[model samples]
Target: MKILICLSNVPDTTTKAKFVNDNTAFDTTGVQWIINPWDELALTRAIELKTDAANTIENITVITVGGKDAEPTMRKALAIGADDAVRIDVEPKDAYFVAAQIAEYLKSNPFDLIFSGIESADYNGSAVGGMVAEFLNAPSVSAVSGLNIEGGQVKITRDIDGGQEEVSVEMPAVLTVQKGIAKEPMIAAMRGIMMARKKPLNVVAPVEVEALTEIVNFEMPQPKPACKMIEPENVKELVDLLQNEAKVI
Candidate 1:
């Protein structure tokens, strides 16, 4: 089995987010980039599948859509256990555009299975995986928490509103993985890190896709209001405030 895992370069969770270039683009200066956390689950599962003897998954390829700066994250994925890496040299503008570029890339090489995060941490738009599946005319399952492969078919369990659902699909499908499906991602060791430098990383330019959305401007959200304290002894006053002043009741 040849599995393709789609990764993303995103700002570290602790990085302070800002906009620049007249608030039209994200301010990447001084930002530390990392692999999208949700993608880690997919990567981990891919690695697991490759290790399983019954499945015999031969190669695990990791791909990303981003500029030059994204290569490090791709390398990181390789270091973590991906056999190879591909970086689409483009600054992703929107989910649709990114999906189109990815779909174009996959058009040439039909993979047995494709994996990606449920959503990117920065944009939080969970549209790319399904869109790519649609473009490839493959079955798609999103936010899958459990996955197993048997005889060229995939069995998946995904979380619903109150429970989980089990699904089955054949090979040559796309899956977007969510958290809780696996443990936290493992860090690359020294040997893995050294080997990653020798691994193949194919960089390709993105195919042109007419962008449908453009950012007009950006504004920070309103600051949260200060907290008001009420004395424990003022029970009646609190009730009155909830009824009349706060109107929360």
Candidate 2:
């Protein structure tokens, strides 16, 4: 069984976000890029699944919709254990266009299981995975926390309303995973990093797909208010402040 993991290149979580071009574009200066955290966990689980000699997993491939700048993240994924990587040669404009490009690729090259993170760290859109599944007319499971292939059966444990639900879906399905998919993302070893240079990173041109939405502007949230300190003797004052200024009570 061949597995395809959809990767997203995002600014590291620790990087300070900055906007430019009159708040119309993200500032890329001195930013470190990495694979989306959730996607990294998905890739880790994919590698773990392939480790079992019984699963008969053929190969693992990572795919992304991005231009040349995204190759570094893809290479990091290869170092994590993907057999190869594919990048659609285009800047991802929006969720729909990105999903369409992936779906277009899937039409020509099929895989038994397709894994996508529930959302991208930068945008947190949470829309691409379901959109890709819709484009392919395939079933999809979202918010998956547990996944395993046992005796050729695909088992998924996902979060539901107030509880968890276990499901088994057919092949050629998409799974959008959240946290807990794996204990933690696998770090690439020195040997794996050297081997990643030899792994194939395929670049394909994107098909024509108009983005459904446009970014008008990006507005940052207002800065948080300073916390006021209170002493043990100021309990009444604190209560007064909470009731009047804070307005919680």
TM-score of every candidate: 0.92, 0.96
Give the best candidate by lDDT: 2
TM-score computed on alpha carbons, candidate 1: 0.92
**Candidate 1 lDDT trough over 10 residues, lowest sum:** 180-189
Tens-place lDDT per residue, model 2, 76-136, is 9999899999999999999999999999999999999999999999988999989999999
Distance from true location, Cα of 127 in model 2, Å: 0.8
- Alpha-carbon error at 230 in model 2, in Å? 1.6
- After superposition, candidate 1 runs with Cα above 4 Å error: 231-249
lDDT, candidate 1, 179-229, per-residue tens: 876787878889999999999999998898977787797778898899777
Judged by whole-model lDDT over C-alpha atoms, candidate 2 comes out at 0.95
